[model samples]
Structures are given as structure tokens and as C-alpha cells.
Target: MPASLSVETAAPLASAADRLRQIAASTVRPDLLGRIDAASRTLADATVRVVVVGQFKQGKSSLVNALVAADVCPVDDIVATAVPTEVRWGQQVSAALVTTLTEDARTIRTPIAPDQLRRLVTERSGAPGAIGTLHAEVTLPRAALAGGLVLVDTPGVGRGNARAATNLTLLPDADAIVMVSDATQELTDPELRFLQQAAALCGRVTFVLSKHDLQHQWRSIHDADREHLADADVDARIIPTSAFLHSVALRDQTPGSRERSGIDQLAAHLQGPVRADVVTQRQLAAAEEIVAVGRLLAMVAQSELDVLLDPASGGVVVHDLERAQKTAEQLTQRSARWQQTLADGVEELIADVDFDLRDRLRKVGREAERLIDSSDPGRSWEQIGAWLADSVTQAVSDNFVWAHERSLHLAGVVADHFSLDGRAALPELSLAGTDQALRAVGGLDFIGSGRLGIGKKLMIGLKGSYGGVLMFGLMTSLAGMALVNPLSLAAGLVVGTFAYRQDAQTRLDGRRAEAKAAVRRLIDEAIFQVGKEARDRSISSKRVLREHFVGVGESFKQSLAESVRLAKRGADMPKPERQLRVERLTADLAELRALCEQAASFSTAHASVALRSAS
Candidate 1:
């Protein structure tokens, strides 16, 4: 069965979402409506992302091809995947290249030949000045992808530091991850750390031991991997697989071949349990949101009923209304404590970030000086320059990531201070554009030595020799000796050598100063660029939270006013009219209560069905 059973299940989910929106609109609860709309899209699309990740040459691409039952991902031993490739369902095989260079660029669906896919996705294929592709998207008709299952083949880890960082970035967005490892070795330290992180970011993870046919001790490796995972307190399933065996079995039509390959079992697990769980989780989330909105509606209706039925309740209700209105007014004021806290916190954060950046650059400067002093700058300037550039870039990237994370943490703290509901959603904090800023800062230039020219060195040496000869010859002449004496000759040689050494030391000091100045310039540029971005993000967060709370305050005030108005109107009516009005209100509340019950029941029933299917 398709994971979501879209045809059978989508209608009810959509209907419930729409009904919630309608209720929200009628009640003037735009916040509730927005939440429903977001949940509705998740239920409608039902995308389950299963990312395939592993070390270099572990047959990750081949495994992806086999799982999808199509050769969508390019597999090569020489050059690994430089960009991620996503495989999804389509009526025909098609491909497109996605680049992160421009926002307005359209993705032209081009017909890519099977042989050319490797070229398009690999970094070695791009022209000297051409833009690199971020990732590739390929779609083909496959039963495994029928239920909106998207399989992403990511770049191999351990290939490069940047590649590993990119892979880590992908984890937060993955619904499930399939980590591939070779049977030849137990999990490496980096791979184990990755698994631990994946377990944290994504709730569902599976380990695949690939190339089982290549190793005779595949089972031992698998058992060792399981033990390692258990020691790390990460619960995950480890399945041994051989792409070669699976392909040969299919081609030869051998009996029990599919079972031996383990591809069939893997496919069954993905298409059945994994798919069902994703769908059920989304369904439950949407159902719960609907129930929350329903409860809000019920609460409002009951308040009105209470006000209309009890004569003495009017004074109490009016007093509560006045108090709520005051609270709402305070939320919009500049003097609000949460607003003040946010402003002060952001200011302090900016100062701290600036100080930290300067301190890092100072350390880099000290290290660069030591390196320059240890060797002749002219002899090893190129290597030292390259090392400095790489180190600076890494430092800048790390700082930017830290700033991004801190900004998010600060936003949460601000939200808490405002007493925002736990379920309130915030926009995704993205530092995607920071890479461009880093690039703009460019690499460090080689700070050449300020040593004197050969002519100047000779002049300085000559001057020192003349001074020594003059002084020694005068002293020797007083002792009744000639001006051109052995004592003057020896003294001239010693003085000239000392002068040359001193000149060289001065040049070295100048070069070190220049290098330190260059490093400082780079750090300053990074701070200007990255710090600007951080400040903008913090300000934007503050604005968003302010507006969200303001909306909440307004909604509360409106609800309270509506209750008070109904109460006042009912009290002014004649006895018979008041009774009729009460009866109508009662009926309306009953209808709303029933709808709320139905929404909850629908959610419960679907959850049970999903659980049964998963089992």
C-alpha cells in the first residue's frame, strides 16, 4: 500500500483542515487559521525524506539506485557525488540542476543523458568560471516512490571537511536517514559521531552495511557495529546489503536471490513501516492542532453562555475584560519588559560577538607571527600564506555558525519572556547567505618582506666597515701603527657581518608586522559583513515576536468583548426574548461541541489505522 493512502486519507485531512480554517475565520482567530494552513500543507504533500549518507566509496549511490529500482543516482569509483541528488516519483525520467547563486533563476527541466549525469553532478566537470551546482533533482516512475517518498543521495563523508559539514546541515531537515557503511570495517569515529548527531536531529535512523559480498566477516562487522551503537545509547537497525549480489540475482533470476541481497527487506521496511509512521505522525500533528482550535472555540462559547445565564456575573466579567484590555495595551507598549529585555539582550550579544571575533583574529595574528619568525619569509611565503587563508576562512565560518545558533537561542528566550504559547511557530533561522559574505572577504594576500635591496645592503655594510676602520685605525695610529692595519681589517669584517644580521632582523620584523596587519584587516571585514547579518537577524526576530504577541493580545481582547456584548444585550431583552436568545445560544454551542468531538474522533481513528498498517 502507498504510505499515506493519499486517495483514501487526503480528503478527510483536507476537510478537517478547511473546517478549522473556517472556524478560525468566523471567530476572527487569524493565528489559528495560519497554523491550520501550515499543517494542512504537510498533510497534503506527505513527503517523507530518506537521506542516504556514508563514507567515501561505500556504494551509497548504488544502494540508492537499488532501493528506488532505478539508476537515478550516478555511481562512480573515481569521482564521488559532489552534490546531493533527490529521487522522487514522476511519470517519466527527468532531471534538473538546482543552483544557489540566484533566487530568481528558473530550474529548466533538461533532458540529461544517463552518461552525462556523472559529469553534471561532479565538481571536476564545471568550467573555470562557471557556477557550481548545489544539488540535482531526478524523478522517475518507481513503486517505491509512489507515496511521496523522496530519497536523497548526499555527498560522501570523510571526503573533505566541508562535505562533512554540508552533510551535517542536511540532518535537521531529514525525516529519516539511511547511513551506509562498508562491511570491510567497523564504523569509524567520524561516522559514529555522525550517527549520534543523526539520532538527535532525526528520530528515525537505519544503518546499512554495504558490500557484504566483498567481505567474508560481514556478520562480525555488523555485530560489532550494533554493539558500538548500543554503547553510544543510540537505538538503530543495522542491515547488511550487497549491491553486486542484488544486481546479479535480478539479472540471473536466481531463486531466493532477493532475500540474499536484502534489498527486498529494506524496500519493505521503507515502503511499509517507515512510510506509515511518517504519515501517521503528520496526521496526528494536524489532528491535534485542529483539536486545539476547537477547544479555543468551545471556551469562548461557554464564556458567552455563562455571561448570558447569570445576572450577577456581568460585574465580574466586565472587570476581567478591563484587566485583559490593560494587559493587551501593555504588550504593544515600548516599555513592556519583554521588549526591553529583547533590546538589551541583542545589544549585549552583538558586543560579545564582536569581542570574540577580535580575540580570535588576535590569536591568528600571534600564530602567523610565530610562523614568519621561524623561517625566511621569501622562502616559504606561499605555503604560509595559503595556510593562513584556509585557517581564517574556517575560523570565520565557525564564528558565523556560532552567531547564527546564538541568535536562535536568544529568540527563544525572548519568546519565553513574553509568555508565548509553546506551540507557537517561528520562522526558520537561515544563514544561507553567509557563504557569499565569506567569499566577498576573499583570501589573505602575501605580505612581502621589507628587506633592503642588494645595493642598500652593500651600502650599509660599507658604512659599518668604514666606521670600524676609522675607529680602529685611529686607535692603532695612536700606538704608532699605519691606518691600513690588520686590527682595522679584522674589526671591519666583524662589524660588517653584524650590520647585515641586524638589517635582516629589521626586515623580518617589518614582514611580521605587515602579516599581522593583513590578518587584522581580514577579521575586520568579516565582522562588518557577518556582524551586520547577525544584527539584522536579531532585529527581525524581535519584530516577528512583537507582532505575533500583539496579534494574540488583540484576539483575546476581541473574544472578551464579544462575550461582554452578548451578556449586555441579553440582559436588556424582555423575559420571553431573553429565554429565546438563551435557547439559540445553547443550540449553537452544542453544534460546535459536536464538531470538536468529531474532529478528535477522526484523528483517533486514523491514528489506530496507521498503527495497524505499520505493524
Candidate 2:
């Protein structure tokens, strides 16, 4: 019942969305606005995804089942969840198999018998083909699922690289993460690492210590885990739970058993703060959208109001509109100040990125050289190569991320140059394509593999020994000693060792040079690719702003023309008729102004609430 009733908690958000829809319809088309329709749909759908993730055999599935009061996810000691399982509210029990036909290009949903869910989700069943199933969505008429809460059971961490990647990728979309771990052990290193990444991506995470009933020392374990999380600087709440106990309590309807199981507290937290925050964010976003629409409407109304209240203001309005039109035209000119700023900014950005990359590679080269001087290249080259690849990848990602942030910041600067009042909202810029460009530069394959066959090492050693014998044996011959004498042998031994060391150092230096060259090539390629993208995005942003202002100028002109027509008509009308028309317009203006104030108040109130919650 709590779950069914939770849907009512989002009434404020729903009302806000409806109010925004009405405002958008009267002013701008709802479909024309970005993020408004999407926010509205989110409010309407009311789905909050809480993904349950953990290591294999950590009782994640059992925990999810207890939370939802449904045996939707398959649980076993040996077999594990291969595909994600989504459990949501439905009138009757039903299930669907969602299959991906092409990564994300297409998907096919097929209705399946609920009994087939376990087999399809398990790796042992092998139900998924080569192009595996994406996930299975199961629907049930449970109270917890009634408020549009979708519980996701993801494959455990530490399964494999593919599974780990999938888990990490899912974090960005999850509204909250319930990290399940057994009470028998403290958090492992890998789990801590995963938590750090998940915290970065999701922002809201809760640690669930499972199997509390089995582990008599769960309290100690929970405290230790809390300490561990604190030391690791992970800000998350930890709740100890016993899924088996919770399940029993639900089945038996035992008094106080629910509270003892700790599932009730977890559920309440999810239904209360988690759900409230989701709704509040959506409400605030919708309020902003409404306010944006109201601003535009108010601008038009104010123009009319000004003319009616003071007929002399009509000329001033027209002049302002004409000036706005001229400014919009200038925005498109190549010689505009903003265009020049963009050109200069991009040139500086490219130089900074190139310099930063080269500097990073130089450091890596120095480290590699130090290691080469200490050991044979064939022995430790693999480690050096791996380190270089990781370092370069991280450096490239950082540079690209920095470029993206800078590009957006620069776009704002350009917007300021175009704005007559210097307060106009800049068009939102998207540099998402730049990320793909950085990835296209590929990994450090040019660094070459460190795996050197024994045959190559042997040949190098033999060549060094041959040189040592030829040079040292001749020196000994000058001392009147046989070529095979002990003196010749001793000289050859020392020379051979020195030659071997020299050869290794030379090869190592050569490889290091090659690695540096490869890194430089990659950096240049990235600069060409990412620099072009930044330039294109800059141009695109300018065009978008230009078009937006151009539209605004047209709207202002039309409003002024209509105002002139109305004023002329009023001058010719009878006094009583003109008075009535003026009164009607006055009332409409008052109502529009009130609506604008209300939208602004909504934003302010929501913002205050958010600040309080954050604090």
C-alpha cells in the first residue's frame, strides 16, 4: 500500500508539468522547447530506477527480491545473473524480453511467460545468443512497484571486463545505487574502486550489508565497512539487512518482524527522500521551463502595455527592435568581435592541448628511460608499455574534457559580446561529438608490444659476445698472448658484459624514442580532430544564437506593429468603447504578470529547498 500510495507524493511535480504545458501552448509550441517535454514525460512516467549491484554471490538478487516483495530475480550459489532484470509495477504478472538488434540502433521486445525469466537471465541457461539479450523486464502488481519504482538487478562486479564495463556504464543512468555486500567480509579493494567510480557517476549511493541473519558478527562488519568507506572518502549511507529474514517476515506476516529485518527502513528511505528528491528536481526543472516561457510572453505583453500606457514609448520600442535586428545581423558576420574572439580562443586552446600532451609524454619518456637503464628492455618492456598506454589514455581524456569545458565557457564569452544588455541566455552548446573524436585516436598501438622472443635476446647477446671476442682478442695478441689465453678470456668476459649492457641500453633508448614519436603522432592527430570539432561547434553555436536573436527581433517587430494598429483603432473609437478595450488589456497584462511572478517564485522556492537538502 505504501508503494501504491507513493505515486501521490509527486502531485506537485505533476501539477507543475501540466501548468508548464498550458503556458507553452499559449506562448511557444510545447514540442519546440527542449528539455520541457522530456521533463514533463519524466514526471508523467514517474519511474525512478534503483539499480542493485555487487560482486557475484553477494546476495544482490535476494536483496532486490526482498525490497520489492517479489521473487523476480534468479538467485543461486553457482549461476549468476548474466543480463539485467527490471521489476516494475503492473496490474498482473507479466514479463518481456528486450533484445538488442544493433547495439543501440534498434530493440525488439517480445512478451514471454513469467516462468521463463529465470532461464533467460542466468548464464547457465545460455538462453541469450551471440548477440545477447539486452535485459528482461518483469512487471508485477506489488505495492513497492506501484509508484513507478523500477528495481534493476545488474550483473555482479568482478565477473569479467565486459560485465564490469556494463556495470560502470549503467551507473550514469541510475537514479540511485544499492551496493550489496555480505556481512561475512569487509569491502574488497575492487569493490571500493567500483564504489568510487559509482559515486562519481551516480552521486547517490547506499551500501547494503546483506546476509545479516547468517553472520553473527554483522554489527562489527557493518562498523568496519563504515570505517572503511569513511577512510576511502566515499560519502554513502550503510544499512545492514537480512534478505532471508525479510522474506520470512513478509510471508508469515509476523508482528515486528518487518522492522527487525531492516528492509522497512530501506524501503522508507527509498520511498521518502529518494522519491521526493527525484520529483523535486523534475518540478524545479519544469518550473524553470515555465519561467522561460513566461519571460518571453511577458516581453511581448510589456511591449503592448508600454504603448497603451504611454503612446510616446512606441517609437522607442521600434528603435530597440531595429537595433536588435542589426546586432543579430552582425553576429553572422565573419569580422564580428565574437567571431574574432572565437578564432583566437580556439588557436590558444589547441596550443595548450598540444603543449599539455607533449609535456605528459615527455614525463612518461623519462620514466621509461630510467626503467630501461636499470633493467633489460625485453624483461620489463611489457610493464612500461602498459603504463604508457594507461598514462596516454588518461592524459588524452583529461585534455579532451578540459577542451569541452573551455569551449562552452568561450561560447558564453562570445554570447556576451553579442548581447546588447550583456545578460541574454546563450544557446546551449553540445560538444558530445568531441569525445568520440578523442576515442577515434585509438590506443597506443604504436608503442609496440613488449613481448620479445627468447631468440631475439639470444641473437643480441651473441652479437655482443662476437664483438667482444674480436676486439679484446686482438688487443691480447698485441701483448704476445695466445688468442685462447686466460688474459684474453678474462678481457673477453669483461668486454662481453659491457657490450651486452650497451646493446640493451641502446635498444631501450631506441624504443623510448619510438614511443615518444608515436605519442606525438597521436597528440597531433587528436589536435587535428578535436580542434576541428571545437571550431565547428563554435561556428554552430554562433549560428544558433544568430537565428535565435533574429527570431526575437521579428517577434518584437510584429508586437510593435500590432500595438500601433491597436492604438490607431483606439483613437478612432468612441470614448466608452476605448475605455472598455483599455480595461480588458490592463486586466490581461496583470494576469500575465502574475503568472510570470508565480513561475519565478516556484524556481526560488525549489532552489531554497534544494539548498536546504544539500546542506
Candidate 3:
């Protein structure tokens, strides 16, 4: 179904290390391969087989059917061949086709046509302009047993719609590729671009310019396509002929065409022994993927096993379960600033309003009754108190709306400038911070909501002694029924406004500090992981590459020494020495003769082995 599943259960017919072992077994050049793989494996996936791809009208289905002598992919639709498809084999067994992708698949079914395929691709993949999917097996006793030479028929590269692009990204897992451009139009820009880029994946490439029957008279078209490929240094076959034309003409009636069955010859070449080595290497690589995946699974978390097996950043470790407690603590500490900033913003609202509601209310209460001097002083005061209460209520309602609006305006202003990393996001924080700000201005009501009594509210919220802080709101009320002369409500308003400003400023500062600390902690952890991984991968890649090179060097040394020894001649010999005057000369001659032959063979095998291993 998924590639992840393929990797997990594959049992990697070979491990990464086993790929080396397999190479040692499969090498045609034992001297070179043994040197290459003895110390460690490298290049296990040695072949790059390419699937010739394009739109329905682009001759993809035709080309593949012709090559394999079987109709492998469906070719009957004008508009809908979009879903991703796969075709795997099980030797010459002729097992049924199995189509799969994210649980939408058909098993034991024949291939589907392009129009039918459109439904599968669009409805299932959620990709635009999708065609139905097809995944069939072409198992002939002769086919699967052909090592690993698989030539797939893919949807168009650039011609397919967006839906096509999403599903068809997987077609080029080939040892080499042969891009088929229609011979009539020749090498169009779209066709040329796809070929140029696909070549990077596998250097082995050939260009097939099909549709030659219509353009046979136009020899210039064939010459042009050939020249383009050659100029790009693309060592690919540029064949200009139609599969249908070739197939039909080869029938008994077309005498001269009988000699040239284009499709038949292409199949024979692809099925030859030349492909054996490439197929073996691909098999080895597939085996290696299976083994490596298995080894890592035992250690991953059961819930996260799929993620670890996933191909994209699969090995990345985010938060481990063990870190939950510490991470929670960090989050809790971090959120305090959010609450604090809002409260600070509320204080700012109160300060910037200019008219403190409490003080203004107090002035209204006193001014309305300041004209009263009663014959019954106490009773007169009672009458004045009733009138003042009404006056204060009316004045507070009317005047305070402006103050409230000012507060709302200031909150929005500050919030608009907030950022998460630089400053808090003002719009969101201002919205979220509203409740905290209201509690700050709500006098006794605000204190009760926070699990703090009026006394504690004064202490924590006012940041002052209980008596002085508690007197601010309560004093305004007392001044309206004064035992003394009227109080300075404006002065009190100014003082209270300052307190609100200070609180807003303090909260903003705290929030900024908290957010910065969070970023710093995250960055520090990332840096540590990067450093550890850098050191580890560096050591691993180097160890793997070095041992491989050393083994190659040792093999080279042995080869060179062996060559020297073989060059030595038994037919020729050095002159013999005499005695007396030649006594000294005779002694030297004996020593020289003894070493000459040995020098030619001295540890040459071991030397070559050492040279390859080191090199």
C-alpha cells in the first residue's frame, strides 16, 4: 500500500552491509569489486532503469506494450489517466495485477483504461484532473527472471495536469532512461526539458523519437532529433518510428516491413545478458532498504513507529514522553506573561482616559450638593445626599462612556503593535487580555475573581500597603458625603491614572522577557542537537568511505607487485664469479644473485592487497 509498509516488512533481502556482501558475490570484475566491497559496501544499487513517461496521447502505453509484447497499461482514454501506478513482478508466474495507494486499490484485476483510471485518481487522491490508477504485474517466466530490468510506463512528465504531477513523481527509479519524443513534431521544448533533467537521475539515457510512419518522408525531422541528443552529449538511441506502424507493417502482407519489427528487436535487446549486472545491483539495494528499516524499528515508540518509518525526516525526534513534565512547567511559566500584559494594558487604559471615573463621580456628588445649607443641618445633609447620589450616577454614566471608549482605543492601539517573537500580537493579545484588564479596573469585583479578597487584591494588584490602596476607590464615595470641605477629585484622578500606566508598563516588560526566554531555550536545544548530529554523521560517513578506499588501495598494490614478478625471466641468468683476485667479487656475486629473483616477488601479493585496502 504505502512505501513505508514496503520498507518495514521487506526483510531487506540484504542489509546495507549485506549489499556489500552481495556485491562481493555478484561482481563480474572480482579484482575491482572485491577491492571495492571487501572493507565495506558502496554502490549496491548500481543500476538506474528509467520508465518512459508522458500523456495518454504521448505514446507511453504504446511504447511499453510494444516493448514487452503485452498490453501492460491501459490505453483507451482521451482525458483521464492521472493516478500514480506501480507494476511489480513475481518472476514468470503471471500473478494477477495489484493496484494500491492509500487504501484505494484493486487486486487480481486486469489493467484499466485511461478514462476509467481518471475516476480513481481524482476521487481518491484529492488531486486535480486525476485519472484512474493502474498497477499491474507483467510476470512471464522470461520477464521476472531477467534480473531487475524493469521498464515502466509513466504518465506524462510536464504534459500531465497538477493531479498527474502529484501521483507521478515516482516513475524514474531506473538505472537509465530513454525519453520518447514524437518524431513528427521533433524535440519540442517540453520534451527536451524533461529529458535534460531526468538524465541527472541516471546518466544512462536514450532518445526514442516515435511516430516515424507519418514523418518518414520528412528525413529532416529524424536528423534534427538525433543532432539535439548528440549535442547534449546524451548517449541515447534516437529511434523515429511508430509502434503501431512497425507492428502492423510487420504482418505477412508488408513484405519489406516484415524484416523490421521495431518493437520485437527492442524487447530482445532489453532482455539480453547486458542487463543482468544492473538488475542484480537493484535487487541488492532493495534488500538493503528492507534490512536497515527493520533494525531501527525495535527502538522507536510503538505509536511513532510509522513516523520513524516515513521517508520524510523520519529519523527526527521531537518531544519525548519523558520530557512532558518539564515542558509543561515551561509552558505554564510562559503563559503568565500573557495574563500580565493584558492587566498592564487595562491600567494603561485607565491612565490615558484623563477623567478617572471614581474621581469624576466624587466631584459630581459634591458639586450637586455644595449649594445646600439646611435649617436642619443633619436633615439638610440627608436631602443633599439623595440629590448628589442621583447627580453622581448620571454624570458618571455620561462622562465615563468617553473614558471607557478611550480605554478601548488605547487597548487596540497597543495590541496592534504587538508581536509574538518581537512584541506580542496586539490584536490577539488585546482581545485575549480584555478580561484581565477589566478585573484591574473593576475595584472590589476584580479582586474576588482571582481568589483574592479585597485586602489581598490591594496588596498584589496595587503593589502597595492595604490601607493606602483600598482608600483610592472608597475615598471617592466618602468625599460625596463629606464631613469636611469638597476634595480635589481631579488630583486623585491624576494619581490613580499614574498607577494604571505603571502597571501596564510593568506587565508589558514581563511578557517581553518571558517570550524571549522561550525562544532562547528552543534555539539552545536545537543548537545542541545540530552539534551532536554533525559530529556523529561526520564520523560515520568518513569511517564508511575511508575503509572502502583503503581496501581498494591494498588490492591495487598486490596487482602491481604480481605484474613485476610475472615479468621476471627464467631463460636468462647473470654471469658467475671467480676466486682469489675475484674472491671479493665472488662473495658479492653470490649475495646479488640470491636477491635478484626474490626482489621480483617479495611480498607482492600482500603488497597489492595492502595497496588496494589503503587506497
Candidate 4:
């Protein structure tokens, strides 16, 4: 952060929480802000919302029924409980089943018995092609709520029933999904997508491979389940349970059999503050990221403002603001390329999977999954650095060219209108240089590579051709916004500012750090003119241009140092696709400069505001 843009001096740990508090007080973007606030508060309150998820008959309701020691959810042989029967501890004094709808709402306070529930909440269409469309909210006893953590029993997803189909919709709300994988069948793609989605929506998601005791050998199944968790990027705190084993214990109502069965143990673990803590953690993590960004932005802005006030500070502010704008432009452009990178990765993965490696013989009995998986799985850290550099290089180069061509004409128009070379230079003159520069940067930066990763995670391997063109097209809408008008470019960049949020658990820690750094970069760009930005300007320039230009050069140097640091960091990630993308970004940056120079050369004076951006 530049000296001019400096703001927050507080320690990092508590800052995010404070930022949230501040945001709560303000009404700006309250809807969006409130989501973060809710997430933050939920995290702080330490509440957990656990959902007992599985196929309809796979004992979902029965598990909740057994765990909560209540029959709140309608459970029967017909597999009814279709539209996500959420049995939670409601604020209402009495037990009630509230079904909120688009048009109206209804509540059933009477304890809904299994048989009666079947009649009231029958199957309906248009719900993932499931049987019912009613939202069932049941109230559980206080003990069951367990510190405000609600246990939702959703209709099993893989059962091909309408209930299971709706599982995707409800998965995001769950902190932990007890995936009661039928000890009988293999986990399907939908199940996998559910886990993937859960991981995306809620950072902390775990799975349960129920009916463990039903199998002859539990070790192999457990191992496979663990591996499955790894592939889906899910964290496994798996416990195998068999209601059948406990049936004997519960049948006689004997406490000993129940504890030995593990069902009681699993249920005990599920209904605790620990589960709520998981949900809270996810919310906190999101809040922390956003606050961190806001902090950096505020700090960077202060640094710029400081430079703006001190003429002695010279052009530092202008330099930094340009850099910040340029960097932002690059990020989005890199995001745009990620789709192709992912596609190429898929091709590479498929290629590798097709290979007949003989090394497996040295390590015998290796399964097909273990054999073909890439050594890097998803590109290694080293690969990431290389990828970024390549993308940046390419992006910079292209944008630079575009800028150079257009800048000459712009320079002629501005005609040194605000010449830095003279005392008569009108500081009041509003040159569009900064604004145009922002446009150049934002324009290319908006070409994001995010599509590929999103598709891989969300579309799964189920999507067919058309590039799933429709899905990609929706994302392309950002491009349209970037192209709208002058101010719209920056606004688009701000509004379209997206975090590449994914549920890849291991990568999450790293991804989070990257997001923070990205925010910092943006702030740095926004306040381009900083006293500290003159690191690159030849100190000897003092002889030629005096105070302002020299100071501008210094500020440019500071900004360059920061860019170099980012580039150096990018060196650690060496994936071919990322490397290619970074090169692309670099290219864009070069082109960006060329265009800016062109505009400068044409304008007899500074445009004052040059923005280069791609949304």
C-alpha cells in the first residue's frame, strides 16, 4: 500500500469483524453487504446447521428420527418427506410445520405423524422432477436444535426421485451433509455434484458413508469413501453407522446396544455445538476475506489521497492509480482464459489417463483410479505461478497494442490540455487519460479464465457440446457491460468484481490468500498516484523535469516494484495453462502501455484521467 493511500493501521486479526460492524451500520449495497454480515454473524454466534442427507429410503428421516429422538419429519415406506423437510428448533413457542411459498404460507402445529405427512405433502412436479413442491419446516425440541443448529432431513438425491433431485438446491444451506451412501450402491455423479456444490457453497462440508456394518469388510469401503472425499475436495470426518445394528439395541430399548451400534454415537456427535461451529467457520471465513479487501482498499486510497494533497508528493498518486487500474484489468482477463486452461487440462488429464504406464507393476494391485491420476492432480503450486505469468504477459501485450493505436488519436484530442511540462498546465483540466487507461485495463482484465474452473466444478463431466455455450454465454454478459460506455467500464469492473470462489478445500486456503492479494492489487491500482510510486523514475531525472516528473517516476518505480513482486509470486505456479495465461496477461499489459503512450503522444497535454479496463 502506498503512503498516499494508507488508511487502516489496525492489526489484521480483528479488522474483518470491525469492518462488518461498520458495513452493518451503512445502508449501501445492504443486500450484498448483509449477506456478508449474516455470514459473519453466523460465524461469530457459533451456530451450526446440520442436514441429514441421503436418498429417501436410505434412512434419512430415520437417521434424523433416531438422532433427534423425535419423529418431526414424515417418514414412511413411500419415501415421502420430499421437499426438504427441515425439522428445526423454531422461535415459535409451539411446534409447527411452516411451509412458505411464493404466493402463500401454511403451518401445521399438530405433530405431523408419518402417515398424515404423506397425505399432506404428496409428490408434485417442477421440483427437480420430484414428487412434491412444498417446503416443510418442522420444529424440534430445544435439545435437538443444539445451540441453534438445525438438522434438515432432505429427500435423497440419487434415488431418481423428485426429492433427491432437489438436493442440489438445499445443499448450499447445509454446513455438513451426512451423505448416507447406501452401503449397497456406488456413489453417482449427482452425489458427487452435490458434494462439489456443498463444498462451493459452504467451506466446511463432510460426508457420511452410512450402513457400514452391513458390509463384510468395512476397511476397503472406508478407504474408497475417503478417496472419494479427496477427489470431490471434501473433508472427511466419516463415521460408519448401521441403523440395523442399532435396531436390536433400540428394539429392546437397551442403552448398551445403542451405544455399541455406533448409530447412537453418530447421532450424539451430530447434535452438538461442534456441528454449529463448522457452519460458523464458513461464514467467518467469507467475512474475513471481504473485510481484508475493504481494509486494503481503504489503506491504499488514503495513500493516494495523501499524495494528492502534497504537491511535493508530485505525480505519485497519478502513477499508482494507473498501475492499480492496469492490474485489475489483467486479473479479469486472466480469469477469462481459465476456461480454456481447464479444457486443456481436461484434455491433458484424459490423455494421461489413457496412457498405459508400466510403473504400476512395481507397485502392484493399484486400482485404475490410482494409476492414471496426474502427479499434480490439479496443477501444482509451481504450475500456478508459470500460468499466471504467461497469461499476464499475453494480456498485457494485446491491450498495450490496442491502447497504443487508440492513444495517438486521444492525445491529439487532449492536445496537452493539461501539460505537466509547464506552470500554465491546468490542474483543473479533466483529462480522460486515467479514465481511458482504466478502460484499457478493465477491458482486458475482464476476460476471465474463471469459466473453465466453474464449469469443471459445477457442470461436472455431465455437460455436452454447445460448449454448454449457453452457460458460457451468460458469463460473457460481463463483457457486454465492460463495453457499454466510459464510466460504465469502471463501474462494471467494480460490480463485476467476482471472487473465484470454489469449494476445492485444499486449494481454498491458497485461493483465499490469492483473493486477498488480488484485492490489495486493486487498491494499489485505484490510488496510482502515490509519493512512494517513484521508485522507477531515474533519480537523475531531477536534472531534466524537476519536482513533478521526477516524483512521477519515483511513484512509477514503487508501483513497478509491487508489480514485480506479484510477478515473482506468480513464478511459483508452473502449470502450462497458467503459464500461458500469465504470458497472455503480460502481453496485454504491454499492449496497455503502448496504447497509453499512443494517447499521451497524441495529446499535447495529459488527459489527466486515463483508464484502461476490461470487465
Candidate 2's residue-wise lDDT over 1-615, tens digit each?
A: 123223443565456446545644654443324435765675565678898888888998988888888788898889899778889899999999886653343788989899887788888755342453367899889898888788899887663223333455465567888898899899987688677767766777889998888888889999999998998899888888888888888789885777778888888888777776666555555555555544554455555556556655667765665565565556556676766776787667666656665565566556656665565455555665556554444444345445545656766776566344323444544333333344445554344444558897677666666766777778888988766767666666677677777876677677666665555565566556655654554556556655554443344344344444454444455656656656866775676566556655756766665676578
Roughly what TM-score does model 4 have, to 2 decimal places? 0.41
Ranking by lDDT: 1, 2, 4, 3
Candidate 1 — number of clashing residue pairs? 0
lDDT head-to-head 1 vs 3, winner? 1
Estimated TM-score for each candidate:
0.71, 0.65, 0.36, 0.41
Deviation (Å) of 600 in candidate 1? 7.1
- Residue-by-residue lDDT tens digits, candidate 1, 260-365: 8888788878777777767766766766666656666655666666767875776776667567657756766778776787688778877776776667656766
Residue 567 deviation, candidate 1, in Å? 4.3
**CA error at residue 72 for candidate 1, angstroms:** 1.3
TM-score, predicted candidate 1 vs. hidden true structure = 0.71
Worst 10 residues of 3 by lDDT: 428-437
lDDT of 3 by residue, 1-615 (tens): 112322332232323334433432432335534433422332343233546654346676677656655555566546434443334344433433343332233334655443444344323334332123334344444453254456665555442132233212342245556576665676765555555555644455656666666665546887887787777666666555467755676444574563343555555455442254344433334333222222211112121322223323222322232243233233224243433444465455444332354455446534532333212222243343344433432333233334334443544543332221121111111101011111122211010111226674354444432333345546655756432223434444454556655664565444434333432342233223322322332333333333332333333333323222211211121223112313432343343333322222223433454466458
TM-score for model 2?
Answer: 0.65
lDDT of each: 0.70, 0.65, 0.40, 0.43
Any idea how many clashes model 2 has? 0
